[model samples]
Target: MANKFIIRWITLCIVLVVASIKPIEADSDRFNACFESCNEKCKNDDYGNAYCEVKCDFDCGAKEVSAKFNIAI
Candidate 1:
């Protein structure tokens, strides 16, 4: 009984660790995609509505990337 309980506890800890890591990985991927897309848009058009859209996308992506890595900027 004690051995079974110990095994369960270890399994739970491993699962928690993995769950936490998964989100960081996913957020990083999202940030990278957003950044790349925003850069492309900005490069294609550098003024007016296109500029605003690109800036917003870049800011949001940077925020997500910083948050995911616990970076301050």
Candidate 2:
């Protein structure tokens, strides 16, 4: 019974770890995409302030993505 409990606990830990890693990877991808898109848009517009504002909005989304991924950004 003790061995069974230990095995169950280890299995649970492994499952949790795997689940957590996936979201972090996904959020990193999302943040990178948003950063790239915002930079591209800013380059095209030639409007510094508007570019900054749009970039800020994208940054906010990136922040949320970090939170969802359990990361600090």
Candidate 3:
């Protein structure tokens, strides 16, 4: 439990740093859709907050790429 707590905080710090450097367009509809969808799925699947956050970021990023290049992700 202690180890997980430490790891979770570490991951959160790293994410925060990256986010600060290249912030997500939180107001965009597509991003909101992707993030909310991912977060809901993760939550329904009983994922931890750290896992959900990372998964959502990845899913939203993929969506952005697909939309940008018109490629099927």
Question: Number of the top candidate by lDDT?
Answer: 3
Ranking of all predicted structures according to lDDT, beginning with the best and ending with the worst: 3, 1, 2
- Prediction-by-prediction clash tally: 0, 0, 0
Error of 3 at 42 (Å): 0.5
In terms of lDDT, the poorest run of 10 residues in model 2 is 22-31
Instruction: Show where candidate 2 strays beyond 4 Å.
Output: 1-26, 48-73
What is the overall TM-score of model 2 with all chains considered together? Answer: 0.35
What does the lDDT read for residue 29 in candidate 3? 82
Global lDDT of model 1? 0.74
Give me the runs in candidate 1 sitting further than 4 Å from their true place: 1-47
lDDT of 1 by residue, 1-73 (tens): 9999999999999999988784334465676677777667667675566675668576966788687678998
What would the C-alpha RMSD of candidate 3 be, to one decimal place? Answer: 14.4
In model 3, where do residues sit more than 4 Å from their true spots? 1-27
Expressed as tens digits, the lDDT of each residue in 2-73 for candidate 3 is 999999999999998988895434447888888988899999999998999998998898878777768996
Q: TM-scores of all models?
A: 0.37, 0.35, 0.57
Residue pairs in candidate 1 whose N, alpha carbon or C atoms collide under 3 angstroms:
none
TM-score of 3: 0.57
